[model samples]
Target: MISINNLTFEIGSRALYDEANWHIKPGDKVGLIGANGAGKSTLLRLIVGQYAPTSGTISMAKDLKIGYLNQDLLSYHSDKSILYVAMEAFERQNQLHAEIEDLLAKLETDYSDDILNKLSDRQLEFEALDGYNVEFKAHEILAGLGFSEEEQKRPLATFSGGWRMRVMLAKILLQTPDILLLDEPTNHMDLPSIKWLENYLQAFDGAIVIVSHDRYFLDRIIKKTVESRKGKLTLYAGNYSFYLEEKELRNELQANQFKNQQAKIKQEERLIERFRAKASKAKMAQSRIKALDRMERIEDVDDDNPTVNFSFKFSKPSGRHVVTLDHISKSYPNLEILKNTSAIIEKGDKIALIGANGKGKSTLLRIVAGADNQFEGKSEHGHNVSQTFFAQHQLEALHLENSILAELQAFAPKHTETELRSILGCFLFTGDDAFKKIKVLSGGEKSRVALAKALTADANFLALDEPTNHLDMQSVNILIQALQQFEGTFIVVSHDRYFLDHVANKIWYIEDKEIKEYPGTYQEYEEWASKRLVKTEVKPEKKVKEEPKVKKEKQAPSEDRTRLLSKKNKELSTLEKKIEEQEISVKDLEQKLADEAVYSDATKLQETTRAYNSAKAELTHYQEQWEQLAEEIMELEND
Candidate 1:
């Protein structure tokens, strides 16, 4: 759909891409990946016409629609509801609605055949585009993106920059252009919302050229990987995993070749040095010199920025059942985010609390950690559940007037400057960087400082909300590993799929105003939730008849397509209804399991847990069956 020919983008005395050529064809889900300063986002901007390349050209198919989700939110006019902003994407549909409304008013005044004909055309166009269902589709998109119905009604200006980015994302999605240019699109999203986006893109027929640092998201969605580095573009035929393996092999091959060349040169240099001193071997010495001169030197491959390595260790351990919420509920005058939700967090639980934005995930964390007391929740802290809360907004709590070194000192006053600076180095803050004032640090830098402070604190229970927001990929990995190894219990509210899958043994899915706990990784949760009831009803399209110009006779299907499609469709519908009923049954059983009376009876508790788990497994089994049936239906229809 788009082409980049001999592209060369430079920034005064520095070149990001030079003579780089790449083509983006239809149905290609390409992951544009590189380090932080590798110009990935800049390249997206160049493609979107925000900034022109220094040289070369980016061309797209004529009149093709291209939707772009900028890494940074663009400025807008006065306050508008999120729903209104998202609906703005369907420009034609909205315009048609307005026109139809105006026409209806005009008809009340007076009407003619000319006006009637115009109204008919407009109505046909509206119906053709499914304009009547725009509101329902918009609402679904908003809800999938993690905005509650009430939150959707709020003015756009009321949201933070991150949430506002979601609104922009919703806008681009509703557009459904031929090509989608998303730059770090998952930056502000939570885990559940990211999953929704993954499913959204999975069904999207258009090509996607995305620049993202999110590893798991890329691994799941991207079919081709493009690495931009050192003024060059490297293309991989497969996903990020394939790219990693191929890059490693290429590096090793180059290293071996480089070593062999160096060895040959050393041998030649020694021979020449010995022969040069002896006139008897003058010819040999000359030959060695020529060989050395003709030898092609191997290029040294070094990373532009060194990877940051760090680990966090807890100073103490929290008691078993570190925090527990009994009959907790939260409401913001108009919206009740949570309702009588109860959970018991144990020590070393390593829970990943995932949900859409503004769904009480943060509120629950605050309530449990005793950070917010206004909520209606009976939170019981176990013996010495000393809490350490880390949030994106809490970075402001750091004294901007103080230097990073000074901040760490405040966390651990006993640690000397040398010790504190060493720890700072692990977080990518070195010598002079350690001395930099907290006031001058970027959001990412401040996040690192806040994390450094939190890690050093003498707390056992950690309540982290979007902790990896500002950290780079390497830092995220390191933090995940550290959390995995940490002795204390922690509840991390993050959208990082890889981090969540690797770190959290338990997932608390907060959705539909309820907290449902699942004892598994995010991937496992996906395996369980993949059971969306399939709709099997298929309507035949209006097929055009052929003209009589040596036309061949059409053969009717002899029990090949229609019957098989109908059978699979019927089976899928039945299984879907059954699964829906099974889900409800499991929910009731789960509620029973949560009852104090059930737990009081040990036999009943065991039976209920086993039954609930089995019922849940059965639901997934039915979903698997539906998946197979759907596949069969698609195959028959395609054939």
Candidate 2:
């Protein structure tokens, strides 16, 4: 547990935290949210003692342990295996094991009681600390973070910065500190690893403070939301969604108060003017004016959520089919990315390509963008299909010497400076900010500039790879709104579920070296995929043998017909009731799939998916039975 009281942190003349106070209680799952420059990461650094507060206190429990994960860990490198690095969290256990090994080696030369006694002591300590299972725990955490068994054994130095960051995350998770301070922990993660981390954090026994731009991730795991805005930390009792609603309500209340105050001031001003004209009330007017001057003013709410008023347009519309891949086959050494995979991108299609990491989502995007020609396939673009490709590398492609406005001007030569600035305004770069050099911008700012450039190109088709990578929640919403209003075709690759759900009308995923399409929103695709997963996991049941039927005794035709009709009607009634109940069950399961708690947990998702699938099957069977019974009764009555 940690307590931050009246914290005032200043960087030069600007204060990031001005008398901000927050208490992170034991077992609290807090989501630290704000705009990109609102000091979320800086607060994390202050909590971990990397940066000292200018005033006030950040106090922690005497025995409380904290683990902080930040982007700076990307610079970490080790020649040792990542598994070994992660297991280093068990410092005492590792030390005991080393001593025990040393003692065993000594025993080969001399069998003294002291040596034997030391070995026995070390072994006891190792067993007590559960030293033997350290490797297994390390391996599990590493694998969950997306490192394979073989990859875990590879030297940490061989991995890229993002992969190394994941290894650091694994190390922090293995440590299981009493409290965790994670800043953008989902930055380098894929959807699968992000889900795995969500489940892990949901079950974590310690307090957690996460600063993430991922809305879906925050909604899934965090119970409390803390917004860092205007140099103050405001707490919300619920998750990100709840924070948005609560903030809107507070803003409305503040706006009303401000309006009432302004009206009262105006009425008083008119009275003062009248009183000043009369000698008798001049003194009273003077006193009232002084009181009014001393009164505290109410500040009106600022508009934080800016709307995207700029519409995206292209010079010429593409043909019906924007792009086509004919039997595309691409492979790398010991890895088959895609084989005989064929797909089409229509002019109006808004596709979201998503899956786990190393699944070639980016590669396929490149193939569609025509950036890569080494793959064996006929990738054809429809007539008038002008395309713009945006990827992480585009950030590096930006000219460091040019201003943001100048950069846009160069990328879109046809657009006037006014039009380019208008597009930049939608991306949150205002009048003077647009004139700032690209080198002076932060990672998120640079990403916004790059995104704005991509949108400005008069292309009918867009292939965006991780376009929301460094954007804040507000910026992401802007991009979402722009894409929603876009009239051209696009296929985007992103791991942000919330962004995808809002921007994509169709889902594309690669499975077994083939591209699969789900013609619905991301949420719909997830529910369907869950059922498909359950189906694959379930085994077939053996057929039971049926006994020979016994013939009934002969009866009067009228009586037999009446009895058969009655039986059929009763069965039909029962089937109808069952069908109704199954429908309810299916609806309930669908609701559960939409619930954050159910979808965030693997066990719950699996259980709910299985139940949903079963309910659907039962509903089908009952409907069939009802129809058969109804037909039989109709036939009997007619006879």
Candidate 3:
């Protein structure tokens, strides 16, 4: 659908792309992956003609429609109703419908030949575009995007920025453009809505190019990954997982090639040096020197190695119970954020708090961390439970006036300036970068500094809210590993599936005004969710019928025994399948949920959550049945 040829773009001295060649074909689901500052978004803009390339051309077929969604730029007014804005995507249809209506009205009268010809032509055009079903299609798209029937009728102005983005997404999805460009699309979506989007995109009949940090989202949706690095693009076939494996293999090969080339160049240089020292071999030495000069230098492939070593050394173990909440309820005016919630954090426990946006996951974290205390329930930190709270806004809470070095040094242990600078360097703040004011730092840089500060506190109980925000995959992985090895208790609120799966042993899911605990990894939680969905879908209705006591007694044993055995077998099979499916679903959801685009679609997320919950419930029921069946089988065998 679109072709980028010999593209070169630069901002001052930093070249974002150099002679980059990339193409987006019809029905292509391409994921743009790269390290922070690698210009994945920039490349997207170049493709959309939002910015002109310094050199080369971006060519597109005539009349090719494109829909681009940027993270920071959304044109929406709160005053307009959500449905009205969404309906605008089919404005052409709406206009045609109106014209057809007007033409029909004219048909009722004795119209001139010119008017008749115009009316007939308009009718043909309207029929060809399926203008009759435009309203129905718009409604379908809006509902799919998670906009409630009532909310869709409400003015867009009443919705928050996140909801506004959903409205924007609904518009684009309804438009069904030839090419879709999305950046960080999933930042605001919940799990249920994300699943809906996955299904939608699976059936999307166009090319899609998205930039996201969510590995699960990419793995599930993308067929190819275009990685930007060091002013070049590398294409990897298959999903994000495939890309990771293939990229590692390619990097290894590149490293080996670089080593071999260096070795050969070094040997040649040695021989040339030796030969040059001999007068008789001076001519040969000169020829060798020329050859060395003419040889193209082997370039090193860039790898996203973790810059910071975030190893935490806890000074002492805390009490058995890290933190406890009892009968906790919180509200903002009439809005009840959380209600009668109770939870416990035991020593060495890693818990993930998950919920929709504004569902009070963060509020719950705050109450546990003692940031907010005006609640109905009691929150108590166990003896010696020294806690460190990393809020989502920690990046913004830093001392902006202080230099990066000064900021870290203020909280850092008393050490030499050089040592302090070295610590800063580990987080990618090196040389004069340490002198840069904290206020001047980018969102990612500020996050790193905040993390550095949190690490220095030496807290035994860590409560982090969205710590993975503004961090690239490399940084997120580093943090994940650090948390995995840390002995401290961790309670985190994050949407980053990879990080959650890697570190969390339990999940506290906030849904339908309740917080439910799942005692397992993300994979197990997914199984439980899937089973729940199955139960809901295939629930058997109860029937009331009178029967004679003698007849009931006679039929009960056989029926009950057969039903029990059949149910047991079915449950066991379902459990086994769920275990396998959950493993895959968790891995898939974790990857895609991390993508920025998937998060943006509230409707899709709502659907995904529904599907996920169904799967989870079904799996949980099956697991319980399987355990019971195992016991029954053992008893029967023993008898």
Q: For candidate 1, which ten residues in a row score worst on lDDT?
A: 533-542
The CA lDDT of each predicted structure is: 0.82, 0.90, 0.79
In candidate 1, position 346 carries an lDDT of: 93
For residues 415-464, write the lDDT of model 2, one tens digit per residue: 99888888999999997998999999988899999999999999889999
Q: By descending lDDT, how would the candidates be arranged? A: 2, 1, 3
User: Model 1, range 1-639, lDDT digits (tens) per residue?
Assistant: 888988999898999999898899998999998876778888888888888988999998788888888845657643989999999999999999999988888888678987788889999999999998988989999999889899899999998777888889998989889989998788988767888899999789999988876888888889999988888778999888888888888888888888888888898898898889898899989988987898789975564344434445555567788988888888898879888878899988889888766678888788877888876768899987777899887887899889899889988886678767766876778779888999999887899888878777777888998888867776676577567756788888888878888989888867667677765577766665554212212222212333442233245544756687777778888998999999999999989998999999999999999999999999999978876675556445433
lDDT-better candidate, 1 vs 2: 2
**Alpha-carbon runs more than 4 Å astray in model 3:** 100-124, 307-310, 331-337, 413-426, 540-639
Model 3, range 420-527, lDDT digits (tens) per residue? 675566566668998899888888888878876776676899999888777877777767766876778989988777778889988987765556676667766676
lDDT of 3 at 531: 64
In model 1, what is the error at residue 104, expressed in angstroms?
A: 5.7
Candidate 1: residue 351 lDDT (0-100): 91
Q: After superposition, how far is residue 542 of candidate 1 from its true place, in Å?
A: 38
